[model samples]
Target: MHPHDKGKDRLRKFVARSEPAHPKLPLVHSTDAYTFTDALEDGNLEPRDCDVFIGEALIYTFYGRPSYRPNMNESATSLDHYLPVCLILKLSFAQDLKRIFPFDTGAFANDYYSTFMHRRMGLGDFALEADLDTPGRVITTFFGSARNYLHAAPDTKTQFDPAQFEARSYAALIDAKNSNAMDSRGSGIEIQIADPISISNWVEAAVVPSTFVQSETGDALRRLNIEILPYNVHSRMKPNEYMSTVTDACLTYYAQKGML
Candidate 1:
């Protein structure tokens, strides 16, 4: 991913944070969604915000690959819908700063200047190198679609049609993309997406029927309907924060962009 495209300097650092923070992810590309996602769950990893950014990038990497037409949706925006994922990553970064640095400025503080540079980089200094060498085809396709924005139908910023894009659940999306395959050797990709607030109760949700929890969705996941715990992450918090942080941060970041 280009440094210009990444949201902000501070935010980009979080995305560059090594997955599992140990195995050293071998400079994978943002498009390698399955491999990258599988790693997040692999080992003792305290991922920073950048990990989630990588997650967002992995999903978006498919956007302009070969043809952004496959990536089209109702909106004309490129990766516009992914703002939620973006914001969530940033919030996690903010949280990390709070715990370790503990901002001297009040909660209202917003500037990157909040950081007091030291001899060495502080906790939030993340790198912004593109993990995967996103294929030229993908990059060209993504931009090509965006270039046709003006030719789109009313309110449509993109020229691609989204018949297959809408009206699909997460399960259907992954299955159609052939990303849902799981190997017995603890391989394949597991995309963990759900309401973060409800995640803490996932274990208990398993025991409690939807009748008790009042969630048909919960019942479905608990039973054979779908894999309740997708993804490799054992810690509920890991995926939970990943889901929440990206959703929240992207919303705010884009909303601010809209204003500008």
Candidate 2:
């Protein structure tokens, strides 16, 4: 059988098996824009099992099917824009993800964190003002091994683990007043996802919106090239403690796997 056929067969079988238990469950067909868009339009809101493939390479396994819930979009507040709302993946494929993608994690750390230096600043301003052209003022941190992936200075505080990663927003400066000056992109804050995939994969991971990744230099960006976040993902967060809570969650997953 052809490769595409095999993938579809796998997806169909997965969905067939999942739907018997979860009638509302939606198994994503492929990590492509059209596939996700069509699923959403078809009201396939609850994603069950999905395949995440970059080009022809399957790098990671994203699990944690949302326990049957309604599409509660009516009461969603601005906090939802910045919270870790997506289903977490085990990232059992972390090594493969980095190997196949081959990015300069160091450059991202230097540009997003060290160059701006906001670790002690405490998340900076809740609201930031900036665009694709400006440096984001807010700081968002993830719990996975961003430092290790980027090969920056070792975290001296502790040994590197795939379970611990951190990244801040390098797109703008955080300031409520200045936030009003920037265009209304998502929540006007940089999103910090801890253990990005280890937590939960976004419902719209494959069909990422254009606004989520606004880069000018044409040099590849981690968000667009690697993470493949949904467009406007910044606007869908749960608020302050969400980051920490998710970090702990990712750590727990790793701990269970004996990787931490």
Candidate 3:
């Protein structure tokens, strides 16, 4: 067998015996209310220009909570100024889509900051140049939030080997305990979906702040037949603070797993 085939076979066996992380968790895509309203009007969630992944829509599998907040420290003129709308999508929605992939950390940071800096430095395409297959990306979901196990180097400061697919797969499967180490609110783990995701059949609900319930956007949301769940954003951790907490959690998880 070819060396690459051997690696894939090993990954297959590893995945067969691995415990999958929160497979049933509702994936949340947080956006500004204006964007959410536009999606509702269009009957689909269109991909925005992401600095890392280019033309892809991002969703966070943050266990049961929303992981994104836009300018949490800044006061908004209205609830909609910050990313106040959370579109909850079923995990199974991927089954109906093409080119859905999972990443252990935010894809842009994973590649731009850690993996292919040269590309970001005007040497090549800004998008990740990793030759990652869909199956390998799928395996990442099994070890979601356990960021350390999903990379050749655990520390974000270190450069990552884009070709070390087998190593990452092996590392994740070897430590099943960290598969669900998702206590941090901002786990930074994300899923990238191909552009123009039709949300009419996929999104289960839209969660927004209670103040938005009577807003114009709320009326528009109700017209779309999507359940609008009112949530308290003030009770949640600030996004900037969550960044620090996420870094600490990653280090703590790595230490607990003896990978630090």
TM-score of each: 0.18, 0.24, 0.51
Point out where model 2 deviates above 4 Å: 1-82, 90-240
The root-mean-square deviation over C-alpha atoms between each candidate and the true structure, in angstroms, is 20.3, 19.4, 10.3
Worst lDDT run of 10 residues, candidate 3, spans 123-132
Q: Candidate 1 residues 150-188, lDDT tens each?
A: 111111222333431211111122122222121110111
Error of 2 at 246 (Å): 0.5
Error of 3 at 75 (Å): 5.6
Question: Which tens-of-lDDT digit does each residue in 1-260 have in candidate 3?
Answer: 21111112333343334344322344457666666777777878876655544454543333233444545565434334454566766545653322222233442243423332233222121112122233333334343433333332222232225554543532332333343232222123344454466677777667666667898777876776767666544443443333333333333433443533
Off by over 4 Å in 1: 4-113, 118-212, 224-260
Ranking by TM-score: 3, 2, 1
| Candidate achieving the largest lDDT | 3
lDDT ranking of the models: 3, 2, 1
Q: Candidate 1 — worst ten consecutive residues by lDDT sum?
A: 182-191
